[model samples]
Target chain A: MSETDARPGYFGRFGGQFVPEALSGAITQLEEAWRDAEADPTFGLELDRLRSQYGGRPTPLYLAERLSEEAGLEVHLKREDLAHTGSHKLNNVVGQALLTTRMGKPRVIAETGAGQHGVATATAAALFGLECVVYMGAEDCRRQRLNVVRMQLLGAEVVPVESGTRTLKDAINEAMRDWVTNVDSTHYLIGSAMGPHPFPLIVRELQKVISVESKAQFAAQAGGLPDAVIACVGGGSNAIGSFAEFIDEPDVQLVGVEAAGEGIGTGRTAATITEGREAVLHGARSIALVDEDGQVKHAHSISAGLDYPGVGPEHAMLADSGRGRYVAATDREAIQGFRRLSELEGIIPALEPSHAIGWLLAHGRDELDAGATVILTVSGRGDKDVDEVVKVMTELGIAGDLGNEVVDADPREDPESDA
Target chain B: MSAVTDAFTRARDEGRAALVIYLPAGFPDMETSRACLEAAADSGADVLEVGFPFSDPMMDGPIIQAASQQALDHGYGVADDLDMCRSLTGEVDVPALVMTYVTIPDTRGFARFADEAAGAGLAGAILPDLPAGESDPWVREARRTGLDTVFLASSVSTDDRIDRIAEVSTGFVYAVGLMGVTGVKDVASDDSRTLVERIRSRTSTPVAVGLGVKTRQQAAEVASFADGVIVGSAVVQAASDGEPAGAAHRVADLVRELRAGVGSR
Candidate 1:
């Protein structure tokens, strides 16, 4: 079903404002501001200018010939990895920062997992001259240490949340607590196409630049739409952005790859659509990894960005309505995809998008025609993941090998050779 | 009238605010929490709010959140909450209500939840996350089961929203004492008086001020305007201060002090 057919603030019985009473006024104000901003031409113009000049919009759509050959398809990459802050997170934050200014809020608060959104939010806050505070899981802080430093360097105070599970969901809980305590002067700059009503809608519209540009660019470059568009799903911001424009075109397939840490049935996966049931988390009712008592379960993933128990409510709707297909990639497969892209395409992708690449390599040939074109979104760069990847690779005994060959002997011929 | 309404009316006849105590079911442990609730009822609690612990409690403060986490860690579920409420209603003279996020009941099926709650002798329910705008299905089932539905109205809620909330609310209109979650604040905000007055003007449903009413002085001050005084975190903290028996003693003492404070008005 189209979004227009859904009730106000609802997407097929999924989305609603299930927040505390204290936040009712603020959410209503945000909805109003969003409506006004959507109607005003100046808002669109300003957002466009920021996207082009500040955020580096219209990111390239390049053909990865070697990777395409490997997949037995015409594989094109939507280069969101080249966007400012090294991800598509900049698009949503820049727009929300403008909305913060428009709503006359002087401060902004955000929650981060892998720190990509945190870095992007910190950058936008610095550019917009707003006071910024980001809540990140303490575990995530240790896992993605460089992004923490990046956020600090951009003048954002990072609060390490030491709560339940101490991951993305807890970070969100802390951020929501902070927002409830300080809603009058602060705007919650949510980084995903999730949360209550206006958040999912607003985030989707803000990040829609991905598919909007790709749709036009592909027509100009290849003269037709791609047969399938694929992207990794966490809270589903980039994937929804990559799928929003193509949702109506029945011929254009939409695919979202989730992180299956070990396997879907192993109880240590983040593949919400595959293994989770319908439940309420954060602020929306979506498919989530929940136990029999309706309590959300902890989700594990090698990619910190996809280490969440819930997905965006709209994605749940899409999945249920058969408008989009959801899949999973194991940590080992993602690592292989990470290495394969670096070797063949000279691009080191963040582990989040490596799930999409991994799925394509494993199932693209079986799922599509031989010459069908596919557009896969590389959502972020791997500069922040190099250390973690190296540690995991070393643990697996495949540190220096391009293939899975384990070299038992030390590469150094002599212990003191370097000295 | 429902048992909740009767309690408020009886408190009005006594010229005092109804004293409501909130504690999560199975907190610390099942036996200790039950003992604490019994002590509260024996000491002079007019109503009991039995909290059903949820995995993600967005509307709770640290003390209650920690208590809830402890309860969940101990493997408490909706069945445990129902059993506690059933026992409390059978043993105590005070009315009891189940407080939880809406998802618990929504997942369990609203009609089934309401029927089971009524069967357990619960007088009402307060779902903090289910606003009046989205409470139709739950309210319909609750009304079918003769259960009162309590909706919260904050100091920031608009007059029109307060009207809607008051119109739909059955037991009482929960007037949030501050623009924050459930916690003990140093002082109750003056905005609650205005909120209570607004609800009073719109509907005659008893208005209870919660979320920051911690001390006797604060309870007395709030009791001057609101028809009911609700306290949660401080009582939970008291229950956690000692062994089960000692904790019961502490809870009884605190409830007596709060009861006196509410009556002082």
Candidate 2:
């Protein structure tokens, strides 16, 4: 992610132009367009204007004082939850949607797991008055019915994908199908930094705005960059988003937390980067938690948003290069952490963000730098996850015990050590 | 019989349904999936469409997707899948075709993939995702290696698309019976019957109806519409069942039943 010593547009061998020959022409054009777009002051100005007016950029950076006290770490929250349509997902969509409009494409197709992105893309399509088709897994449609309705209400066609694994990956498969079939008039609005080459890099590039702002906010409020940056990893947008900025700040420690479901040993974890090695899982060569036979294994998470079998290839390379440490947290811990923030800080962290807090709790903060700031991007609000968290809490027999735990917990009690 | 084409002709004359079972290269693993394909072939399957797993297979239904996911899980991706296709020629002479979309071919270079497919002892290649209009460039490139480029036709294709597809397609015209994804419920309707007749009149290329034809009853019933009843989802459903070989036997029995139906009708 660091631009210095950058290997001619490569992101640590994870980012390159590995497009199909048919797309190489388009890829080359996009590369030039993007390079020009990045260089042009007007492009940034217009993008920022749209981000403010349409996406409601610079959502908020709130101090989770009470929650940080409970976690025993100073957990400051970057409120991507306040973004339009309730998640950091909007950040990437708004950029791509605007770019699609700029590229003169009138139709957009997107793939969705939890439908957060489907709804977001639908919202963008509706705003721009472009035809939108969102491919959602039959399984995901059942689980996230509200998002299905939300997308439909926004005038996007929801294509229920009854294909492979019946989940996020299948939705992507369907979307890619639609793209190849309709590429003449449509642009595929990828939702994550997990697909083929340029995609992982592009999504990260669009998402870098988060870390760019978070850094300035932290410096302005807390006097300087945080000692550590934390974010949950699915396809690793927010983590990669936040990590991109501080990747070269040698003094800063970068930590990515993954969902361990019941436990890391249960084989039901979404800890791809922590548990995986170099392999392709969803197109991009990344750290994928594949089985011994090299197939993408089923990833389990209490949160549907975090249940992906792989991390973005860039994150895999980053984790592999020891640029950051990837860790895991169990379902119970994330749930407890979710409740801890709600009770102590009066902020309900999205399940994906709660995974970061989960890791913070499981690994006592003794490992963190003493009095060193740990900033966790609260990527979204917990509104979508409230019912599920309630179920998990009741199943853990901790429905009413959250109050006591928040008071007893200490996120920074142990302090993150340099080691 | 000339392998795959011969299987279709023989089935046509015998008034029996030709079951073309499709298995992605790695459904859990290449060897296991190859065995499953063998089980299908050994159980009297007339032809086989061994899928070359691409990272994305948009036209597939859930069953195939699950199979592909299993293949991915078993470390059978595009490269492994091509190897599996190559190994098929050594295992059985049952004219196997590798079914993959066009984008992957475009990525690996169509000519290169075609050469590989032929070298792997593959009979031909079917790229369902390629449009009839766009087939000229890539298919022309694909044909350089002597691998027949099979194009698909839909029930909804106009006379023009049908003619275009028929013109370039060498092996067989994959006639999609319905206007939907794979593995959907196929209730034989007047539209399906008409679509089959419409395609039959438009091209001399042998037409095979795929999609939604699952049960033996459906296969037997649908066989009346086209030269071959391409049973994909059902074969997959059976192959993925707990008892793969036993399920294949059931499929063979279904093919026999359909064959009887075609003979009588």
Candidate 3:
């Protein structure tokens, strides 16, 4: 259905034209319209217009001068953090919500991990005037009280999933069950590239647009691909989004940073690629941190966004096929990076992406090639994580809860507030 | 012989009750699944219905769904699944059938499934979803392919449906023993006797009651009205009770208990 895919499949096992037989009628229509719309010169023009007039564009690219002086390497930040709702997640959600209207699916259901995707989905649903239901784990609903309120304020009906481990996995399971039960009117806007058949392929395509923009931005800034690209992998969407373009380029290295909570060897880690053995989960062949008996293991992480035990199938295949390398960073190192970046750069990174920054920093600035640029996917802003960071830092004995300015010391906004 | 005709003849001639054992293919693993199928046949089961698991099995309870999920997690696909009926080939001393939701046969292609299932050493298919009105085409196709099309005669089925179901159903009539999912239940309970009587008036074909005929006493009571008794969930229970070696012995013991109970009854 894509114009660029004149050659069979996308990156071998990456993309497929697979769709459920029931979706044949609707997918055909969508494929035709998407193909034609993609070819039209005004497609980008209209998208740009909407992006600027309706939404915002060209967020910001700031150099972390304060942090660079401390680390001895200049770190340039792409301010997707400044964009509407505070994360790069909006880039794909807005695009897909547009496609849903084009495809005539009047409603959408999304499964959320830490409620970022839930908020993003609710935002899309509001913009497109479509009905939306966001399924959140009972645990996540309690942990991410703010995003739950954000989703509810955006007019989305938040459903609590009380099955399985009472987390994202269960919420995803329940959402998929809901979609299967209501496949007639539902377009499951998967937050990541995973699940059965075409889902992994489809979501990656939607999320690829972010990297496409970043690629152009980086090329304009530095004249070639970055030496190493890094991003956090919860469900592996943001990292996969950025690294996919350079997958076959040979020289460009892709590094996915997983949260090694405590550590990977300790058995409490969200490092799916590192700690997880091979197993089929969700719906595809992937690596999951499962016990010998085949039950999925609960993952641990400092950041709620990185708290999943397994990730999307493509990341698993990529790691298995040796196309990409995965590394784990301890939460302690991530906390240090959080304090380091905030203290040195005056810009606080999201706790999720901070793991990648932590890993890259821990390996030393000497590890980076001279004049070699490394693009760290600043997936989300640190606003949600500010309070969590303060709590962690205070616990780690680095800083006391200093009045109102302290990150963890700041009282979280009332759960009922609509901001 | 038509699987239906063969079932009736087996019940009429052997004077031995028919044991209908159900298993979800790919449970544990493909090897274990095949072993269980062979074990079911070797245990003197008259008919073995390999349950093809669906994501949504409306009629099934937790036990079967859990078994299905376990199987699906092991990389079982829809194409390779239908062909699993061939596992009964060498060890199948009894007629082998596929008991699936109507979705499988329909989604896989009706004619193709009928032909393939027959070619793959499959004797029959018992589809709970395909009602008589929609079953005509599949029944005809199955018959043409020399495959048996067995229909589940539910407790809730109207008297009119029992007549139509028996007309197209070539295998020995299957009278559901319980109102709910497949599991162990009192074999000779009043519900069993009443359901047996309901099927008795509809067809001359030997009637067998399946679903929850756990103990031999119930089997004996069920054997009173129905010519044969079909036991599924208890067999699965026996098969899964312990180690693989123990599974065969457990099943054999249960089968013995059932035969003795039915003989005395």
Candidate 4:
């Protein structure tokens, strides 16, 4: 069993197999297949070969001279943006696709919000020559039309879902429905490190490479570990990946930044850990944005990827246990960080990771020790988000003043409120 | 006499399977929904499994989902559903069961939710999303309040899982007919019969076959082998296919047909 797959699969009372009984048999089969894949040595050898030969392994850890000078501290960037699919989503998809093949299932289905995971899962499906169908909300299909077309071009069918809220949560519901109907021949390639049982454990193990590589690279480049490792939290795939290896090192703080949308306390944000309650969502028990009536609310974020109302269960446990700090960055501050990285380092980062950069530039700057090093996981490139950022800036009439604003920490992330 | 066990025992004594009709509470409107529940009992429905509409119904298909959305649009919440159950149980001498998602109880506090549901005169609760393994809190509270907790078995479930679900289940074990959501199908599959047999071997708990048992003939087919047959989407469809005032009439007619279907078995 994986470290997190504790019998009924809970991360300290967070994750469990909370799906319908129609899906119980399928989920159990998936859990068994995952265990088998973990034991087989060839699975590792094949994945390694694919990573090095096809996925461009060991994406460089670059020292940001300009950004470091601006902050007066040495800042290093783990360049996951340079991976084959331009995001860290490929790490989980590639691993899951391998498991699908081992299970001998000829088809895969997935649900995506920002379309990054859709494109990545489609890419792996194409490589494996499997039939793939992706469910995206009608609104997200309209917003991320380009990525929708990209998925179609990659030989995957893109189905637009028009149920509940018409967003990521709806897309997931549709995908789960489809999986239930076609459980015999299909595998649901869940994008994030969330969902029932083996998915959270499976996704975290697949994504742990980010922190593992960053640890070794930091030891080689800076001759010591960075004082802090930061990543953005949507469903918390990249954040969990970036923090899993450093969880035991108490001195090296693990920071997970969430999208504040307008602001955390403003009642319109995706800051799940900061402003959410324990609820069952998408077959997992985690912190979720819900109304007083127990209806899952629509989370607003400029970044579609970070617009999810619920997060991975492990992130909930980590935050609850005080091992990981969960914070938020407003849209305006994220745009400022987006502009700073592009102008200072010539790297246009994805909006999801820009939340992490936003936190580092604003409140995180004062928290780090003087001259201490900080490592940030730039989870994806900004090709999918460039137009959205420009539109927001132009609409606000703050074209050139985007980088002039600084954000402060919302007190909801304070540990005192946690009790 | 209003408990689920009494209903099942009566049906067994009569040499017929129990006819359980699943309807969403406050569908269309509260008055008509209460009328429908009474009509169901009057039309020989042995048990009432009233669905509490959830915004995100993961286990429901198009028909039930649409009915749930309609109920939600009519301003139905946990309190309204419980009040509907109280009113229905007070008026009718049948076991009124509440079918809901785990989020309702999880959000409202599991023990408190179960206790309040019991206080509302509900004989039992059916949480489609909660498996036997993760049901400690709700099960404890439900047992404490004398409310039966029903668990589900599916075609994909192993013998061990069936045994696990049957042990904690008090009302009955729901045996899913197929590996799909709650919807209408042309016929009840043989998998459900085999699953019911599997559950029977594991425990002495009554087994109710549900999911895709839509038409009268399908209900009859399922009733031949199981202790109870549940028809959800079919009755909901009949109620929603006409004007709101006429929903109870349509439900009463469908309940008569389903009751006949069970009696024929």
TM-score of chain B of 4: 0.97
Alpha-carbon runs more than 4 Å astray in model 3 = A1-46, A292-294, A364-367, A390-399, A402-419, B1-265
Candidate topping lDDT: 1
Docking class of 4: medium
A1-419 per-residue lDDT for model 2 (tens digits): 44235454445655443222223334444556666767878778877887899888887676777767665777778888888888888878877777777778899999887778888899989888899999988877877777888899999999998755667766776776565445557778888887665577778888898888888988888888788998888888889898888987988899988888878778788888777656544444456665433445677888777777777877777786898888888888898778777777778878888888777766746678655688788888787777667666777787775335546556566567423
What would the per-residue lDDT of candidate 3 be over residues A1-419, giving only the tens digit for each residue? 32133233333333333222223334344456556656777765666666656556666556566655555554666666666777767766776677677777889999887788889889989988989999998877877778999999999999987655667877776675555445557777878866544556556766676667777777887677767777889888888877778777778777889999989799788898998876445544466787543446778888888888777877876786776888888998888777676677676778888888788778637666654567777777787776666666677776564434533543356554545
lDDT at A284 for candidate 4?
93
Candidate 1 residues lying further than 4 Å off, grouped into runs, are A397-419
Worst 10-residue lDDT window, candidate 4 chain A: A400-409
The window of 10 residues in a row where model 1 chain A has the poorest summed lDDT is: A402-411
lDDT of each: 0.91, 0.72, 0.70, 0.88
B1-265 per-residue lDDT for model 3 (tens digits) = 6765675576557665666667788775667777777766675566778877665443444466567766766767655666677756545767788877654565456788788788778888887655563466688788888887776675556677678878987777777665445562343357667766887777777678877677777777776667777776676676777876666567677877876765554
**Candidate 3 residue pairs in backbone clash:** A66-A344, A67-A344, A67-A345, A390-A408, B4-B170, B4-B171, B187-B218, B188-B218
Tens-digit lDDT track of model 4 for B210-251: 888877888889999999999888988888898988988999
Give the lowest summed-lDDT range of ten residues in model 1 chain B: B180-189
State residue A260's C-alpha deviation in candidate 2, in Å: 0.8
Cα lDDT, model 2, residue A26: 42
Candidate 2: lDDT of A131? 97
CAPRI verdict (incorrect, acceptable, medium, high) for model 1: medium
lDDT of 1 by residue, A70-135 (tens): 989999999999999999999999989988999999999999999999999999999999999999
TM-score quality measure for candidate 3? 0.62
